[model samples]
Target chain A: MRERRIIAIASGKGGTGKTTIAVNLAAVMEGPVAYVDCDVEEPNGHIFLKPAITAANSVAIPVPIVDKEKCTGCARCVTACRYNALACVKGRVLVFTELCHGCGGCMLACPEHAISECDHEIGVVETGRANDICFVQGRLKIGVAMSPPLIRAAKAASPSEGTVILDAPPGTSCPVIAAVKDSDFVVLVTEPTPFGLHDLTLAVDTVRQIGIPFGVVVNRCDIGDDRVTDYCQREEIPILIEIPDDRRIAEAYSRGCMAVESLPDVRPFFLQLDLRIRDLLSAPNGVQSAT
Target chain B: MKELVVVSGKGGTGKTSIVAAFAALTPSKVLADCDVDAADLHLVLQPEIRSRNEFRSGHEAVIRQDACIGCGACLVNCRFDAIRTVSNADLAWMFGAGIHACNDCDVCVRSCPLRSLDMINAMREASGEARKTAFVVDPISCEGCGVCVDICPVKAISFPERVSGEWFISDTRHGPMVHARLGIAADNSGKLVSLVRQQARQLAQDQNKEFILVDGPPGIGCPVIASLTGASLVLIVTEPTLSGQHDLQRVAELARHFRIPAVVGVNKWDLNPDMTDAIEAAAVTLDATPVGRIRYDRAVTAAQVAGKSVLEYSNNGVADDIRNVWAAVSALMQLDKPKANREAP
Candidate 1:
C-alpha cells in the first residue's frame, strides 16, 4: 500500500558505476524490484541480467510531414523553423528528421496548411524480465541522434510496483536529465581516483540541482586517492560504502556477474546502503546531505 | 575531419581517463566535451577559455499585469497546466508567474476579457553558460529545446539566438588545445562540438602532428555522435564491473556503428581480472585490439593528486601498463611502421 520507493543511480560522469549499483541493488532488494535502464543509447543492465526478450518496441517522436500536393513552396515552414531542420531549397521543403526536434513550428506556419504531424522512429524500447526482476531498456534506432525521447519512453515503462531502480545514462547531459526525473533517491557511485573525484563532484552537483536526495558509494577504495573521500567529507555528503579494491571481485564482474551476485555476502552491504538511503529520504527535517 | 570519440557505456568505466590520456599521449588532437552537463576533462587538461555564449531555448510565458482583469479564459486553453489563478491582487502581482515554464502564445493575453494579460517574447530559463577557452570548450546545453515555440495556446517559446560566446585557442602541455565554451544552457551543442573539433583539426594540420586525442562526452547522444565521426581509431577506456562490461559492449557496438577501429583498455584490471579477461574477450568479439589491462593501483591516485598523467608518474605497475598501451597504440595506428612519404593535407 505504501508508495514504492524509487531510487535512481545517475552520474554526470559516465562509467561511474550507476548501472552496476542499479542492477545489483535491484537483484538484492528485499521487496519486488523493477529495474529500468534509462540509458537508452546503450542499455547495459540487460548484459548483466541477460533477460529474455518479452517485448521489443520502437520509440517515435512527432515530426512534421509536408504534404507535397498541399505545399505551396512559399518557404513559410522553412522560415518558421529555428533549427534549420526544415528548409525550402529550390522551391521544395527538405526535412531532416534527425535534425528535427518536432517543435511543429512548420506545421503551424504553413500557408497552405500542408504540414501534418508524422511519427519518426528514434529508437527501440525493450521490455523483459530477468531473475524475477522486471526490466525495460531502450535501444536508439541506428543513427537516431536524439536520446532523451527514448529515455523518456523507458522511464514511462515503469512497473508501478514495490521498488524501482533506474540505471541512468552517464554525464549531466540532457539524457541524464531525462533519466533522473521523478526519482525518490539517487545513488552516485564512483571510484577514488582524481578522475573519479573530479567526476563525482560533477555528478553530485547535478543531483543537487535536480533536487534529489543522494549519497556516494566509493568503489575501488584502496586503489584511488582519498580526494573523493575528502571531497565527500568537505561537502558533508554521506559516504554510504567504500567497496575496496579486490581482484576476485573484479574477476567476477568481468565474467558478467555483479560482485554481489557472485558473493552473496555483499548483499548485506547493499541492504545497509539501502537502509541509509531510506533514512535519508525519510528524515523529518528533509535535510540536504552536506559536503 | 576525423572524429575519434572516447566512450565506455558503463558508468565509471574510465572513458574519460583514456580520453585524457589520449589527449596527453597525442599532440594535435582536437578536443570536445560532449557531456555538457557534467563536463570534467577540463579539470585535467586545464583548457583556458576564450569565449562565452548564451544558449537560449524555448520561451517561458510571462503575464504582463499592467492592464487589468482576472478572467479565467487564460486558464482554460493552457495545455501545459502552467497557469494558475491566484487571489486577485493588483493585476500585475496576480498574474506574476514569470515565463520560466510558460509557453507564451499570448493566448492568455487574448482570452482575458479585460485584456489585462500580455505575452511578449517571454524569456525562459537559460540552459547554461559557455566559455570558449584555449584548449577547452564548455558548451552549456540549453535544457529548453525550442519546442514551446509551438502552441503556447500563448505563443510563449521564443526561438532566439542570444549571444552566448565565441571560440578560444588555448595552449596545453601536450600541444595546442582547441576548445570552446558556450554561454551556459545553449542548444545545438553537438554542432558546436563539431566546430571545436574542426579547429582542432586545423591546428593539428598546421602543426603537422600525427595524433589528435579527444575526450568525448558520455552517452550515445548527439555530441557523442559528433565525437565519433571520421576518426582513424577509438580507444575505449573501461573498468571491470557489471556496468563496465555493459558500457564496453555498447561503446564497442557504437564504434562498430561508425565503422571505425576500436581499442580497449580496462583500467583497474587487477581489481577484477576475470571481468577484465571477459572484457578482453568481448573486445576480441568487437574485433578491436585489447591494448592494455591496467591494474588497480594506488599510484594512479597519487599521480592524479600530483596533477600528472599516469605515464608521467613514478614507474609503477600502472605506468607500465600505460607504456604498453602506447606501444600497442603505435602498432594499431601503424605509427611505428615504415611508410612512404605522402603529401600533407
Candidate 2:
C-alpha cells in the first residue's frame, strides 16, 4: 500500500483563491479526496464545499494548573517560563493562560511537582462530507491567540487512504507552516499584482526552506500585470495554471457556489490541475526538477 | 493624533490599497504598515528608507567549543529537536541535520559536568568548530524557551537576543511611512507590529500630525489583535464573497472583544449586491457601522503596478466612491473639519 499524497494549497497573501482551488480541485478529483481547511482563523473552504458536518471534536492545549497546597513558593516555574506567562504573586503562582504556548516546559521546571496540565479548549475539528469528498475544517474560538494547534488538529483528521488537499491560511507564519508541513506538494495560489508577486516570493521561500516541492497557480490572471509570470520564470518556479478573470466565476464564489458546478469552463482547468499534480508527484525528479 | 487602523480578517481585500489611498488624501498624517508578515503597502507607497533597525525579539542558544567536551546530554533533553552533536568526521554537521531547530533551552550546559555549553547570542551561530566537539543550537526552530537554561548544571548557556527581523522608517510621497519585514518563518510578528505602531504613533505626535493611518495584517490572530489594540477606529475592508462575509463577522467579533469601534465596507460590492446587503446587516448586528461600499475596479491593480495611489492614477467611479467612503468614515469618527472652517493644505 502506498502512502497517500497530500497537496497543500497556500498563499502568502490572502484572497488569492487558495480555498477556491482547494475546494474545486477536491470536487473534480478522480479518487477519494479529503479536503482539509487548515485556516483555523477563518475556515472558508466549507462555504464552497458546503459540507454537512458529521462529527466535531474539541481541540485543546495543555495549560498548567498549580496546586497551591503543594507549592512552596519556590518561583521555579516563573523563572522557567520564557513567554512571561507565569508569575509569582506574593505566596502564590499565577498563570496567564492566553500567553501560554502550551510548550509544557513549566511542568518540568517545578521542583515541588505542584504543576499539572489541564485541557484548555481553543477550537474545534469537524469531520464531514461534500458529496463524494471527505471534508474537514478547524475553527478557532473567538479571541484565541494561537491557531497552529487547531490547524494540526484539522490536518490530523485527514483520511488515511486518499488524496488530501489542505487549504492553508494566508501569510508566511506559524499557521501556514503547520498546514503545509509534511505535504507531498504545495500549490501556491496568487495573483499577478505587486502584492501577489511579493507574497509569492515569500511563500516560495517558505516552502523551499521547509524542503517541499511547490508550484504556482496564478489567480485573477486578467486583472493584474505580467510581473508574476516574469518573476516565476526568473525564479524557475513552475506555473501550473492560470485562472482567468470571469464575472460568472466571481459571482458564483460570492454566492458560495463551487466553480466546477456553476461554470462549466472552470471544470476542465481543475481537472487538468488534478492530472498535472499526479504527473508531478509520479515524476522521478519531483516538482522542482520538472521545470 | 487619532489612529485609524485598516484591517481585513481575510487577506487580499484591499486593506493596503485603501490605506495607501488614505495616506495620499491626508495632508498631516503618518502611515504605519503593521502587516509585518506579508507587508505590501511598501510596494505601493515606494518609501525611501531613512532609517532601518534590526527587530530582535526571541532568543537562540549557542555552544562554546573552547570550554566544551563532546556530550550528548543536550540532544536528549531537547524537546524541539534543535540540538545535535557535531564532530569533525561530519564537517557538514552544521547543514546536515537539526541545524535550525533550537528552542533556547540550556539543559545541555546545565547537565554537562564540565559546563561547555553557553547560550551566547540567540540569532548568531558560532563558527570554527574544526577541532573541538560541541553541541550546536539550530536558531531557526528555537522558541526562546528557557528550559535548557534551567537544567544546565554548569550554567554555560546564555540567552542572547535574536534578531527576528527588521523594521524601517521611510519617507514616501504621501508622508513618513513605517514598515517592517519579519524574517522567513520567524515568530513574534505581534511584537514587531506593536513596535511599528509605537514608532508611528510617536512620529505622529512629534510631527503634530492629525492622524496616523495604519495598514493592518490579515487574520484575527496575534498580529491583527496587536494592530487593533488602542486604535481610535478600525475600518474592516472585505469583499462580497461568502468567505469574506464570514470573516467580516469574526473580525467584528474581535473588535467587540477588544472594545474597539469598527466600521465595515465591502470592496467590489456590486459583484454580489445581495451578499453585500447581507454583510451590511451582519455588521449592524455586531454594532459595527456599515460604511459606504466601493465598486469593483481594475484601477486598483493598475495603480499598484504604476506605484501610485488610485487618486493619482484614475478618475473613475471607483476612485470617487473611495473618496466618498473616506468622507463618510471621517464624519462617523468626527475627524472631519467643517468645510468652510478648514484650511487648505
In Å, residue B325's CA in model 2 sits off its true spot by: 1.3
| Highest DockQ model number | 2
lDDT for each residue of candidate 1 in A1-291, tens digit (9 for 90 to 100): 647778888765565556667888888777678888888877778878889879988788888888999888999788767667888888889898888876566775676879998899998888889978988888876556788778878888878778888888766545776788678888888887766776677677666766777888887788756788888888888888877766666566566677687887777777878877778877835446442
lDDT of 2 by residue, B144-168 (tens): 7766555554455777888879999
User: How many backbone collisions does model 1 have?
Assistant: 69
Which portions of model 1 miss their true places by more than 4 Å?
Answer: A288-291, B1-4, B19-37, B46-147, B150-168, B180-189, B205-210, B238-246, B261-298, B327-345
lDDT of 1 at A4: 77
lDDT of 1 at A40: 81
Report chain A TM-scores, every model: 0.95, 0.98
| lDDT value, candidate 1, whole model | 0.66
* A115 Cα displacement, candidate 1 (Å): 1.7
Q: How well does each candidate reproduce the native contacts, as fnat?
A: 0.50, 0.73
Best by TM-score: 2
What C-alpha lDDT do the candidate models reach, one value each? 0.66, 0.83
In angstroms, give how far residue A51 of model 2 lies from its true place: 1.1
